[model samples]
Target: MLDAAVFQGLSWNLLDDFRQLFTYPFMVNALEAGTIVAVMAGVTGWFMVLRRQAFAGHTLSVIAFPGAAAAGWAGVPLALGYFGFCGAGALVLAAIAGTRRSLGAESAAIGSLQALALALGFVFVSLSHSILTGLDSLLFGTFLGITRSQVLVLLVVAVATVAVTAFAARPLFFASVDSDVARASGVPVRLLGLGFLLVLGLSVAETSQITGALLVFALLVTPAATAHRLTPRPWLGLTLAVALALAVTWAGLALAYFSIYPVGFYVTSLSFGVYVLVRIVTR
Candidate 1:
């Protein structure tokens, strides 16, 4: 009888805590944006890990720094700069990788590009005195001040990204798994590669709004990496990745609400913890 009473009390407390998360307007907007970002990151990051393009994804993330910084300096929407520059950076990375086709050469080219991007980002920060004002938010993210309009933008981008990814899933999967064989078997290998990179760019830009530029790997890589460690099948891995991302996002937001820490720190810590736990369990 005592155990049953204790269990009931615990369950009610948990329910109340959950309800508290949605009690605020800003919290609702944050969750909505976080959900969209998590889904997009999970799907795109799964393929990114499969294709061994984590480097390319990281490069796009680095480019996001300058993109957001430039936008703040120019008084334009941060999303516009994020998508514009990341899309352009993806083009450059794709063009370079296409030309070289060697691991060493490609790594060197990407490293060079990353360096230049960081340098330019600093320049923008210096140019826009106000850029540093919210620099922490650009690097580490915040759940506060999320507007309804931002949530709407995230929904639109998420739908478009998911749709394009679904349309190209079959061929993209084939090419990702075995490009040479897929190409010989009539897959549009090159076009699919470019299309996937573009989609990745879009997802990265959208994710940056939530997790910030430097910490994008928290959502984009960790959950996908954890799911891959947990499963080999594509559908199962994709579902698990999305689930893990959403879990971390909600938990992070909740924990941040009760503390003085930044949401990104909680998110990244939760994501890394789950990834490590999965690695240990799988091993």
Candidate 2:
């Protein structure tokens, strides 16, 4: 967990700035990891936004905090905790929703889960009894020290997520817009809901690695939301969402490569800027 986001600054020339993006192995790894995360998050988040589950997405992001903190405390791999706890959280939310509760009730359950997750994260940090040096990275993220192995892991998970999401896209879309109609049509609405929740959890966990737990929405929601505002067509919106995600990610890397700021900040800022611009233009 390296806190340093960049090893050098730009040379103030076009070619030099581009060259700086790959001047180091760490930077190259960071770009690779970011690209995988952006694509995965973009596709999954498009569905998440459509389902109006931003709260659930946010809760899962919070859920990743305890997972990562506890893993660091216990000296295990952080990715294990990230995916495990987020998956558990998603299942819990799905179960609560499965009860056929009202939207208000489901929201209450999700809020409670978020609170518990935060408390658990604090407990893990306190119980560690030492400075959690990677604390900043856990919350704010940094792209300075990612390894090739980590990049490979991201690539595998991203590919799986995109593949499954694409395979189920039609029914998932139908279910998301009108579950009652989709169910009436024998689309297995309940099962699709469960599967999508798991996919959301997986995307959050992966995006959390780059944007950090607190900032997962930077990649997961903003790009998708922006695309939704721009297009009514599903496939086009999804493609645009992924394209925006890549833009923010690559631009952030380039900017962070020439500055002392963390890549997360640049990413979040760029994403927000784009989203705001879209809102204004669409208004």
Candidate 3:
């Protein structure tokens, strides 16, 4: 009879597969992009979770999906369309729903935009008369086929994201943790809020390419949530979040290379599992 764990596709022979992970250039690229995406998502997501903007982040991802699908239909890079549409959506949200009191309205607007984008994606798919494999993969990423060009783009975006987040860290944190005090202290809380949203839009765009727009929320939320449970200090939480994200991405990649499932599936599951473990351990 087959070994029970082997039947489930888990193996101690993953070390052999680890060597194979770097044998192919494409796999190398995937690992690079995935690492960047994980770090950015983890860092930014920490603030998002703390500020209770998970719903907004989810909305951004959903809205980006149709743009990506449309790009595929038009025979262009999915990143271009996803970033444009999501950036627009974010700006619109900020303009129409600028204050804490208007959060409900912002959510409603995001929902409407998500529906509209999905409908457009379907229309584009029908018009193109093409296979939906790419679109489906974008919705639920398959890490095995990542290309060199995409990897380069991911690196550029990751670097830019790090820079923007670093520059905005002080005021962003001040506003996020205590907006009233920040504003009273002469912080431009309104601009800071909009700035954070814009950065979040970029993060969502970059991650959606790797994890699919739908699953991006997993990476963005899980690491940050887990880190928050372990630390109350903002800087420590951010650092821990980044570390946890790196661990999840690396672990997931290793598991996927040795297993039968997609990398996105393994990564997301591992992240959630880590969060649960952290919570239990802390408790």
Q: Pick the candidate with the highest lDDT.
A: 2
Each model's TM-score?
0.93, 0.96, 0.90
Worst window of 10 by summed lDDT in candidate 2 = 1-10
List, in order, the clash count of every candidate structure.
Answer: 0, 0, 0
Pairs with steric clashes in candidate 3: none
Q: Summing lDDT over every window of 10 consecutive residues in candidate 1, give the lowest-scoring window.
A: 2-11
Ranking by TM-score: 2, 1, 3
Candidate 1 residue lDDT tens string, 191-277: 898888989999899988888898999999999999999999999999999999999998887777666678889999999999888
- List where candidate 3 sits over 4 angstroms from the true fold: 1-14, 99-101, 131-133
Descending-lDDT candidate ranking: 2, 1, 3
Q: Write the per-residue lDDT of candidate 3 for residues 27-87, one digit (tens) a residue.
A: 6887898898988998889989988888888888887787787787888887787788778
- CA lDDT of every candidate: 0.88, 0.89, 0.80
Name the better of 2 and 3 by TM-score: 2
Cα error, residue 41 of model 2, in Å, equals 0.7
TM-score of 2: 0.96
Instruction: Find the candidate with the highest TM-score and give its number.
Output: 2
lDDT of 2 by residue, 1-283 (tens): 2334445555678897788677779889989999999999889989999999999999999999999889888988788889999999889989988998889988998899999999999899888877344777888887856888888888998899899999999999999999889999999998998999999998988888888899898999999999999999999999999999999999988888777777889999999999999999999
